[model samples]
Target: MSETISPAQFHRAPGVTDWRVTGTGPQAVFAARSLGEASGLVAPVVAAAERFGVRPDVDVRPEAVVVRVPPGPDGIPAAATDFAAAVSQAAHELGMTPDPSRVQSVGLYVAQHSAADARPFFVAALGYEELGDTDAVDPLRCGPQLAFNPITGDVPSRGRTHLDVFVPADQAPARVEAALAAGGRLVDDSYAPAWWSLASPENHGVDIASWTDTTD
Candidate 1:
């Protein structure tokens, strides 16, 4: 069983908002209207983390900069609060916005006849290491987590590629509701407490997931 962080545990830190606390760490995304703005934030944020003796994993995309603070002795929430505050201050000074709603972690799904047969190919091709028996993850914590799902029967019309969007456990219900309200449909809830499958109007699949135990 993986360690799970609850909303209460995450929210205990003051001034930390919009950060999704996971088993590994706390993550947040800052939105940049332009690539230049996103680029500008990297140095200052990195410097700030270094000043605090923490190294954060940062991914700067064209529209956003995602930061994840790994768990330390001070703990993830504390470290994340410090990192997020630094980044938020830097972003504000640069006229950028911290969009907590955009904070999400994605996992890639590959439907295969047998995970045993397919896992090795992806592990070698992507230079990814195994996380569990069926999942391969980026050692650098940059790329999306890859999950190989066993498909024993004929392939579905929807295809093999699907995405898992991980959010805080407390936020899952609202996220699911928002998706359904936005013209999406529920595909399956049989995997609840782990994930809920949803399909877009175009039938593209996505799963809304929570890292914490949601079995209750």
Candidate 2:
């Protein structure tokens, strides 16, 4: 076993604690206060995740180093090096050399599912007005509104992500009924005088939470 060192013997590296990584897949990238101001590049980290398909497991620190991918034939030297080089160029544009060590992006993807007959529930029942439609990323609309996209496959096993939409203190029940009348199946009815959860038949769930200020 290697010998353990004490705090007095620790060495510090310059620019070590200065970056953040986020996201996964093709969208992976790094973020920092600024790039000259940044000590590294962003793309390689994304590339690493894309090629390796796994992110580093982190533990033991507020600022963690997550190696977003594992080494293998897919993440061979050539790809890794190329990704690093791309990161270098990106850094140069920002007035610095590449530091592949730091990369990440913050992003979220929500998959909305609905029936071919999804409109009335969103429009009439939910009291949501249609915003507009665009083909660039399929139709996206917001609702006092629950906008859904038609999907043709087995329903997902479980929801990986969910949103908690807090209703106005007095509007909770109305919102819940609107959801129900519109064919949104209800799954749970228990509440702690604070919040309740509702799930659609398809298992898309939402939590209606009550807001309370401390002065109470």
**Each prediction's TM-score versus the true structure:** 0.67, 0.26
Q: How many Å off is the CA of 162 in candidate 1?
A: 4.4
Instruction: Give each model's whole-structure lDDT.
Output: 0.73, 0.37
Model 1: residues with Cα > 4 Å off, grouped in runs: 1-8, 22-24, 70-78, 109-117, 148-162, 168-184, 190-194, 199-205, 211-216
lDDT of 2 by residue, 1-216 (tens): 222221111112122222222112111123345433433333444554366343332211223222322222222222333343344345446554322333322211233443334454445644545433411111222122233444556365322434455433344567678878877866666763355667776876676544320002
Clashing pairs in 1: none
The digit string of per-residue lDDT tens for model 1 on 105-210 reads 7788877664235778888999999876778888887788898887777454433778878877767888999999999999999977577999999998988988
Model 2 steric clash pairs: 21-104, 22-104, 22-105, 29-104, 30-103, 30-104, 35-38, 56-67
Every model's Cα RMSD, please? 5.1, 17.0
